[model samples]
Target: MNSVQSLIQPQVLAQIGFAGIVALTLTGALIAVFPRNILYNILGLIVCLTGVAGIFVYLGSPFIALMELLIYVGAICISIIFAIMLSRPLHLSLPKRALPKVGLALGVGAAVFIMLSAIISRTEWQPAAMRSSDWSIATLGAYLLTRYNLVFEVISLVLLVAILGAIIIAGYARRSPS
Candidate 1:
């Protein structure tokens, strides 16, 4: 066998990785959105986000992958957990939803999925004419502080506001009669 044939096949590995990601994404979505329990949903969201970070890593952007892990898994998920704990008592069971409402939600979600799939199937993605083969952490750091400084600032601001709001709301809920 040739040297190339003896080596691990990139395409096969890529396909397996893609399959794993897709499975994780679907499983997470089901657990997050379908479950009535808020805690399960949050945990599922974390799983989905982690899988997405893995996908980003596969796309040759380890910096983004790390950021994904940090921002989503570290910050957002922890905040959400804190919110859940502060707002709702674990002993209290949530009330069941009406069947009609559940059916309506399912219908809407299915329609959206079909529409999105069709759009994705029809779209033709094109690469830049002069695409550079430079995928570096230094370049990403420079761009984050330079080109995407506003976005970074906005995200930080948003996170700060969310934390403040969560604290206020939870405090109010605790004081007020529900």
Candidate 2:
């Protein structure tokens, strides 16, 4: 087959896959934020995060994709669900939306989106003078330990505190009548 035909074949398939992911992400975010059902919102957030993890995979960071699945999908979502269970029954309906604030929020979101798009289109992104040829997991791990050691340690400490705080909060809430 000709180069043009080969390019078109793969490009079309890639575009289709990208569109599917975009749809999944948007749909999940809509369901998460707009739904009155908390359980549905949590499920939608999980779907959205999964789509994001897939995007990370496509961006050539399988490590980040796995970390996203481990931290967000495994830990964060489960913790949120536990907090939801502790705080409120699934049967309870959320309060009605305030139409004025909803309109304001939509307007702000649209403005921000337009501004960001304009800025991105106008900017020229330049690579470093000497780009590294290595994109290996070993290099990433070394960077995490050496160059980014402080950030890595801080994040671990933060996660540890979050878990301890969640446990304390749940304990306190349990002791008090709601």
Candidate 3:
């Protein structure tokens, strides 16, 4: 339709898209941090991560974006969901929120926010004169394996241990009475 075309100019559309992505990211972050439900928090985190991936695409690195999607949204969230399923009933009663605890948390959050805002506002930001804009997955993998091999290995071992511990816990739970 002419109306649709009129509203969707390419350059303006790109800026609108960026704004929408930023809105999505902020909305997700707020939902993740402020919600009472654990599942809602996880879903919000996924949304935030998806928005971050879109931002990475805007920044010219789709590989990192894909990894962000695969690792955080796919693997981590799925594993967390499985863990929740294995450990607790869907109808488990949530603990009542204590007012004093919530007030303390809010005070801490406010303090951190003010401190960070001041730091960020005062700090200077400048782009490097020469920066490599490589977005290749192969290059990223090579760098991780070569330069950050120890970190990669440690993370792998940690994941392995976590998976094994989950299995053991599940096995024990299965043998016990429901």
What is the C-alpha local distance difference test score of each model?
0.85, 0.85, 0.85
How many clashing pairs per prediction, in order?
0, 0, 0
Model 3 gets an lDDT of 0.85
Reference-based TM-score, model 2:
0.84
Query: What ranking of all candidate models by TM-score puts the best one first?
Result: 2, 1, 3
Which candidate, 1 or 3, would have the higher lDDT against the true structure? 3
Query: Candidate 1: misplaced stretches above 4 Å?
Result: 1-8, 88-91, 163-174
Model 2 Cα lDDT, one tens digit per residue, 1-178: 6866765797776776777777888888898888888889999999998888878877878889899989998999998898788667653867789999999999999999999999999999888999878879999899999999999999999989987897787665557655
Q: What's the C-alpha lDDT at position 167 in model 3?
A: 77
lDDT value, residue 24 of candidate 1? 95
Mind giving the per-residue lDDT tens digits that candidate 1 earns over 36-151? 88888888999899899988988888788899999999998998798678656862576688999999999998999999999999999788889888787888789899999999
What is the Å distance of residue 124 in model 3 from its true position? 1.4
The root-mean-square deviation over C-alpha atoms between each candidate and the true structure, in angstroms, is 3.5, 3.0, 3.3
Q: How large an RMSD does model 2 have? A: 3.0
TM values, all candidates: 0.80, 0.84, 0.77
Tell how far residue 148 is off in model 3, in angstroms: 2.3
The candidate, 2 or 3, that scores higher on TM-score is 2
Pairs in steric clash, model 1: none
lDDT of 3 by residue, 66-158 (tens): 989999899988888877776687526556788899999999999999999999999898889999877678888998999999999999999
